[model samples]
Target: MKILIGNRNYSSWSLRPWLVLRHFEIPFEDEVLMLSGSGWREALQRRSPTGKVPVLIDGELAVAETIAIIEYLAEKFPDRAIWPRDQGDRALARSAAAEMHAGFSTLRSRAPMNLRASHPGKVDLDAVAGDLHRVETLWGSLLEKSGGPYLFGAFSAADAMFAPVATRLRTYELPVSDRVAGYVEAIYALPAFQDWLAKALQEPWVVDDDEIDVIQGRVAPGTLA
Candidate 1:
């Protein structure tokens, strides 16, 4: 199987399913498509049915969307424990993942995921306070219940979904409680995540749209060095 992804530094959506495959020891290859520059959009449109990155191509089947790709993987590999094994735990995991998929717009918009950049204080706390609270509440509750270094206790798909959020919290130096901070560290310590981070730091392409400095007007567009 092959997964088409965007630049490692800026493509949080792409990172989700990719992490699942890697963490579970699934065999797959990945291709990186530039997220910006001339013809990039057309390139994505040609490669992905949804005209987006992180499309999984397995033979004739192409899966668009992160959650869909993850579900497909779980279905294909039932022995892998892609989600929590218990029925109740599985439901909770899916619930949390779906929430992450649809919610957190305020935090997401204000602090776009950029693994290669660290801009503490760039985000306005007032703008994303509610979203941050929700994140802490959700993650804290899960961690407390699971007694985990991960949300579901063993690095499941739910953790994959929130991996980028952990990055965002750390990158922005957002205020988080001790428990939430520990959870973030656990995410960073994942070997799969570490591998992704190494590649992200080496990425050359920069998507201006996700650059906080540019968005905040502290750095002029196209002036990044």
Candidate 2:
């Protein structure tokens, strides 16, 4: 199997399937197409019909979209246990993942995922506060219901689905409750997350336009990326 991903620093969508594969210890060849330059368009077109990153190519199947790729992986490798075995938990997990896939447009648009950002950048209050509230509510409600650690008590697809948003909230310094903050920290501390961070820190290409806005001017205080 081979997976094509965008630059590690700014591609939250790309990170989703990569992290899921990493966390599950699924062996796959990785082709990281460094972005922030003009060459990515041609490369992305060849790998992904939609000209997007994070395309998964297996022996005879090609999958795009993080959620779709993950679902395909789960079905193909049932032993990986990507989702819960229990029917109820699995159903809830799917629900959460679907919500993540479709909602949170506000936060995504205002606070683009830049793991290398200096500080918790300023929140676009008008554009993002509502989504922030909804996300916080989602985390709080899930944690309160599940009672600890991850949203579903174990590392499931739901966690994988929300991992990028956790990074986004950390980057933008969105207001979140203590429980949600801890949840975000947990996702950040995962070994897969650490691996991605380490790789991102080493990347040299930076999109000048997006790289221009540095609210705190020093890259997230003590952040790894």
Candidate 3:
């Protein structure tokens, strides 16, 4: 399979399926498109019906959207254990992934994912408190049940769906409990995640749009250079 993605540095949507593919050692080709600038839309349109990044193109089928791509992969590689084996865990995992997929707009808008931006302290988190609580409650219960380094006992699609949230929490330095912070650390420490982060640090592109606080002169640029 070939996955067309935006830059590893800024595209959280692109990161999901890419991480899953890499984590499971599924051999796949990837093409990165600049998330900004002229012609990028045309480039995306060519590969995906929805004209979105993170489109997975198999032999004859094309999958758009992160969740759809993940579901497709799960079906294609059933033995890979992309989701949990236990029916209850599988249902909960799907629900968690779905929640991450469709909900959390408040947090998403206030804390845009910027791999190269530094927000040293909390900002606009109050506006997103409800959403934050939802995340924490969902995660806390799951972790308590699974006794996990991941949301589930294993790193499933739910983790992949929420991977960008971990980066957002880190980038903004949001005040989370020790449990949530530990979860973030575990996600960051994953070899797949670290590989993505290293590439993000080295990439030349800086998404001016995602640099929310920096553009507003609220926080300084967090670029490595």
Candidate 4:
């Protein structure tokens, strides 16, 4: 199997399913396509049915969307605990993952995921206050119930879905409870996440749209190094 991804520093969507594959010791290769510039769009059009990155290609089957890719992986590898093993816990995990997929627009827009950069105070707290509260509540409740270093006790697809959010909270220095902070640290400490972070820091390409400095007008476009 192969996963086509975008720039490591900026592609949160790509990181989700990739983490699952790596964390579960699944065998796969990955190819990086620049998120912008020179045939990137054309490449995506050719390879992806939806013209998006993080498409999973397994023989003739191509899976688009992060949630779909993860669900596919779980179905393909029944032995692996891709989600919580208990039926109730599995339902809760899936609900949270789906919420992540469809919600948190303000936080996501204001603080795009950029693993290599930190821009505290750049994001307007007022804009994302509600979203942050939701994050704290959701994560805190789940962590308390699961007694977790992760949302479902062990790192699962739900954590993979929120991994980028953890990065966003830290990168923007957003206010969160100690519980949420601990969960964020747990995400960073995952060996699979650490591997991804190492590659992300080394990436030469930058996606201007995802850079908070550029978005906030503090840094001129195309000026990032």
Candidate 1 Cα outliers beyond 4 Å, as residue runs: none
lDDT tens per residue, model 2, 1-225: 999998888888888899889999999988887664567678778778678888999988888889899999999889987998888879988998999889998777667777787545476676787888888888788788888588877788889889889988787777788999999998988898999999988887675434425433534422322
* lDDT per residue (tens digit) for residues 57-158 in model 3: 898988889999999999999999999989999999999998888999988877888787787665676788898798789989999999989988889889
lDDT of 1 by residue, 33-100 (tens): 88899999998899999899899999999999999999999999999999999999999999999999
Residues 1-225, candidate 4, lDDT per residue (tens digit)?
999998999999999999999999999999998887778788889988999988999999999999999999999998999998999999999999999999999999999999988888889999999999999999999999999999989999999999999999989899999999999999999999999999999989877899887888888978887
* Top candidate when judged by TM-score against the true structure: 1
Alpha-carbon local distance difference test for all models: 0.95, 0.81, 0.86, 0.94
TM for candidate 2 is: 0.89
lDDT against true structure, model 4: 0.94
Query: Clashing residue pairs in candidate 4, if any?
Result: none
Flag the better candidate by TM-score, 2 or 4: 4
Model 2: lDDT equals 0.81
C-alpha positional error of residue 188 in candidate 2 after TM-score superposition, expressed in Å: 1.1
Q: For every model in order, what is the number of clashing pairs? A: 0, 2, 0, 0
Between candidates 1 and 2, name the one with more favorable lDDT.
1
Candidate 1 clash pair list: none
Model 2 weakest 10-residue run by lDDT: 216-225
Clashing pairs in 2: 118-219, 118-220
